[model samples]
Target: MLLRKPAASELSAEPILSAAENYSGEMHAIDTGVRVDAVEFARGRVALGRLLAKRGIGYGDRVVMAVANGPLFAAALCAVLARGASPLILHAKTPAAEMRRYAERYAARMVFGDGSSETEYRETGLEPYLVEAADWARLLCANVKIVDESAGNVSLVLPGVPLHPTSGTTGQPKVALRPGRPAIAEAAHYIETTGIQASDTILVAAPQSHAYCYGMGTMVPLLCGASIITMRGFEAGLVQSALRDTNVTVVPAVPAMLGSLMFGTRGDLFARVNTVFSAGAPLNEKTAKAFANKFGIAVRPLYGTTETGGIAISLPGSQAVAGICVGPAMKDVEVDVRDDGQGLAPGLGMTYVRSESMMTGYLDENGLDQSFVVDGWFKTGDIANQDTEGRIYLHGRQSEVINVAGMKVIPSEVENVLLRISGVIEAKVYSREHRTGSQSVQAAVVAHGVDDADVRAHCEKNLVYYKRPSMISFVEALPRNATGKIDMAALSNL
Candidate 1:
């Protein structure tokens, strides 16, 4: 399933904006029904690009887009890319402090924001392209022609730079950057891997700032000529309404959002959603099974990183299985398991990747370097075993692996078994050093009507004695980060 690289000229000339031209003339986007066309989209982007250029934005300059999901956000991003400047998109809901740090770290020259964000930027003495009130109409109606000559070079000067954040519950999130070649390759791989087509209508509920939303939610749909339904934010009711209203066929969401749609909302939220892809964190088998049983549709668990792009490994709707075996490597990508920094036999040790879509490097105060790889393969911190069939089963991060009496215990393995208990909602297991100079496993669980005895009994049936938790702590709910991943650092403090 190797994807031959298409020439840059062919890709650039391809009608990415044709959906707005040839498709439905009156389509509902956000709160308005607007007719779209390639010409109009082109015109809008040119107008915005010209404005950005006049404001001193040039090729290779970083323009931070801190806007919400909508037509403007899409147009602005495409405009920036088309004009030869790199757009550094940040989640609109990201904390002001974090956003400021990203802008400073990247040395972004200008920022595009809505009214609320404009206020925040103003206090920081930064100029913001505030797209609210009269400015919105002015910017969109500028009528500047986008000159094709300014498309600039496809190759980036910095090549790979951290464009998105990883789900870090330990401390400040780690950012990974994929270069142009790998980024485009990964985007294409995701579309091919999922069998996404021009006819598929994708419902994007994740924030446009996140990689899942930005790549799958925006880039793939455009590249594949699929219609995208963008939501301002995730509300269980809004998701249900959009599912029915838009005839959305495919949905990519985090587990937290899926859990809410499956149990929090009643009356056929999944009725129109044929394929549901869940990622960003591990999905427990119980939740996956329950969703499938209730919705009569498979909940496909996907695995990847911002550095890697969308769904590197995923089960298709037809081959979906319960729990987290994130299928196999996508087309044009390779996955290997390693032990002691050497490639291991199939189905054992740490997972390593060598793919067209892998990130180039990480950029920080110290500048960028190829941080996570040895030779050519990028060592994914995740520990896993791949079956002969090539299905990958994740066993948690290597940093989190516990050594109990010299035998390694992966916390996710224990937590998976614990989550299957009747009343257990969420569980986290980790290793702690004991006074006796041995490492012992501790479990933190969020349950309803399930006590330590019940959880212990459940684990006893599924796990070996050496893998069982030495102690269990109960919490009303597990703390999660902004991306809805469990906050392990916060949990450690608890």
Candidate 2:
């Protein structure tokens, strides 16, 4: 009698780890490289896995991770997968209050990060692990006893949590929990569609917690057996050095990072780069062309969201023609641009996509809100149009998603914090478009005692730097429309 071996569930990281083991490439960081072959990857996985196991982080337990984007963070991610546990990865500099709230919300078994972050987590009265990314890299290098593997050679489990968070009108963060683990197929599609090579070295220049960075930095490279060069944050000096020193094949960068490279540094930055993908926000076509002219590699626009996965990528070797062309829908993905038949041919309207990687829906106090997803199509709240050539041209977003150098900031989220300050009766935030084609956060506040400086200081303590209001107008009262609703246009004009 012939029998089939047990298979991992749909959402586990095992598939990628297993495939990664077949390739001999190491995961390189600013410090050094760690071999990713099956045996070596297993060693690191087991060492960390044993540590987590000792801490009572076993199968199905949830762990919260607040670490910088680097080798140690990557190793912790591997450890989470090895122990069959769910992880909620946050920015290394996430505020202590925010980190504690997330840990409580997710019911995390333990928290992990560097010593400094651990101190923050400790203030929450929760169990936290203080581990360094460099130390994990070293541990992966040392000879260690292999812990017994999980029950299956490939075990997939969906975390159903957030490494990225979006917000609602109420200013509360909402996480989309996709049901199944189709990550293997999703990652494969990304690898194949992006033309990833086994010999390639990928550079992740964004925060590892961001969706784009996590997918490009962690998933795609791991599955393809490609070396990954990561940074804790967007450091221009570190990025320039990595590109100059390493034959960096692909760079997944936001527009701001590329902008710095354009004006601050030049020459041979693109000598070895196979592809450079600009996502999170739009890139200036003029600067893009100038860089392409100098480097021989065109800056390609990429479009995706925390909910939509990666929707489109600029076709390799293709230059922008007219509007912002985010190439075409990736493999195994279908995009249907709906305009209510407004007679706008290839009209600008809401974008919808059906893909294996689309998130199930938003999760919050309201439970899962799949209203955004009708049938199998997920509504990507961005306004876009597609030409006959199947290229996607993005216009703007449905909501005020301030793109401060590719860091997404929801206006209501900042406004909520603004309202919390003493004497702040009303608050409205908006995005101001810059000459460089990117956007910055700005706000108009109606308060009694707070000055512009006070408002800025409040935001500094409450929100991330990108989310803080760069320009603030302390108005006596905000203008309202006929319906008694705050006129966003008038606020923007202010």
Candidate 3:
């Protein structure tokens, strides 16, 4: 395992929820079809923490949350942190079996959100708590801590920051633990780079499960005392509506979401947006140009990995794209290219980084193919070249980390799922680029009896929307080359 918990704090730091309450009452969070002020959001965390405390959850306990992006989700995360219980925050659409596996592995105290089976958890001493939106909101209003602001002085003691999930070649999920020490600094960095003002209303339109969105959208905005507008997920029409309704100034979105919103009929929707920042995947050249032409602004790229969070981000008024450039590294991030022993000026090689919030490595697994860290630098498997001005341009990845929309899909993970099918003999999954300049998951399977639909259905059970194969082809055999190995070239042709 590559994960190591940060040194435990002896003296109490300030409680995250209490710090959040320092935001002015005028600051609000909009999501789940309702609006609540910043104090109320903080109060929600306080009250939820009280409830967890009452239920015997204490410091260092693990809470599994499967939540969508919204104010409640953000507040719940804060509640876990305030109570000193680290969260294993899962995507709302995570499969039930995977949730169970995580719960069992960690011996989770509670599971919150959808797709968690009550029966499976009953045996593991795990408690399942389905989030009641109305209840959390009501609890927000009912928090006694908010009534007496003196309670803000007592800080919450965390064992560490919350955890992030990463997958290996075998497709078994592992937790990547980040250091809590750099979290607040990274949040402040976003505020400094973006020039977020007290009155700015940042939009949390992307998935909160992403470290970027959670840090930038939830954490930074709260620290800056800025308001936020969020939706569950990005739909072109829904996002357009939120933009109009909220007059959203700053948007944290992925390239695919931007492509969908821009290419559609909703023109002039981005007029109010001060900036559109994209991460999760590289913004395609075609998408960037179209956005700049239509909106009179470039879609800036925010590049990083699940392991190393926020390596580089394009600040406001910065040019969004210049030959696949992802601007310069953000504050407190050191970037290096490990090309033999060459200098760090700029050449194609593996990207190495030492960042404020980078994870130690994967948890619960003994060893993996490549070491996540060397010396002190975290090895990012991206092929890149940096210009003299410090602008970095990505060529591609050294591994098969497929970027479908903005979500990272490990090819072997999908291939492993395919092989699980009863009639499947061999399976290979790869991405195919569409003319729209986006990628789709495609699979070629050597199987009998089961058709393409069956294979797809099986995938639907295990994988999320983006991870499922968009197209499936069943054949008598998978073509092999001179070495008697599966030929990805011939597979792509099929």
C-alpha lDDT of residue 421 in model 2: 88
Q: Model 3: residues >4 Å from true position, as ranges?
A: 1-5, 10-19, 25-31, 114-160, 168-172, 315-323, 341-346, 365-371, 401-494
Pairs of colliding residues, candidate 2: 10-181, 11-157, 11-181, 12-156, 12-157, 72-133
- Tell me model 1's lDDT, rounded to 2 decimals: 0.64
Count of clashing residue pairs in every prediction: 4, 6, 1
Give the candidate order by descending TM-score: 1, 2, 3
Which one wins on TM-score?
A: 1
Q: Write the per-residue lDDT of candidate 3 for residues 1-494, one digit (tens) a residue.
A: 22333346411224344446676523333444667776566667677778767766678666777767666776777777777777777876665556656655655556665434656445444444443334434221111111222221112223535777765223445676554545555676677776877777788777777677877776777677777777666667777777777667888877657666765635677788887888766565556766788888777888877677778876555554432578878877888866854222245666888866666455552422125666668877676777787777775455555777777676655776787787776676788978888888888887878897888789889988988998898887767532123566788798
TM-score of each: 0.82, 0.71, 0.70
Q: Is candidate 1 or candidate 3 better by TM-score?
A: 1
> For model 1, how does the per-residue alpha-carbon lDDT over 1-494 read when each residue is reduced to its tens digit?
11223344322312333322333221135443443444455566667767767767676565556666656666776666655665666776654445556655565555565424545655655444533222232331111122222222212243112256664323346555544555556668887787877778787777767777677776676667677776667778777777767778888888878777875565476677668888888887777777777788877877886766653556655334446588887887788876754232244687778776766555444444454555657777777887788878777787787878877787887887887687888788877777898888899888899887887788788988989998899998778765677877787776
lDDT of 2 by residue, 354-465 (tens): 8878765564442335576667787766667788988898755556566677566756557667777878766667889878898988888777877988887888899878
Q: What is candidate 3's CA lDDT for residue 344?
A: 24
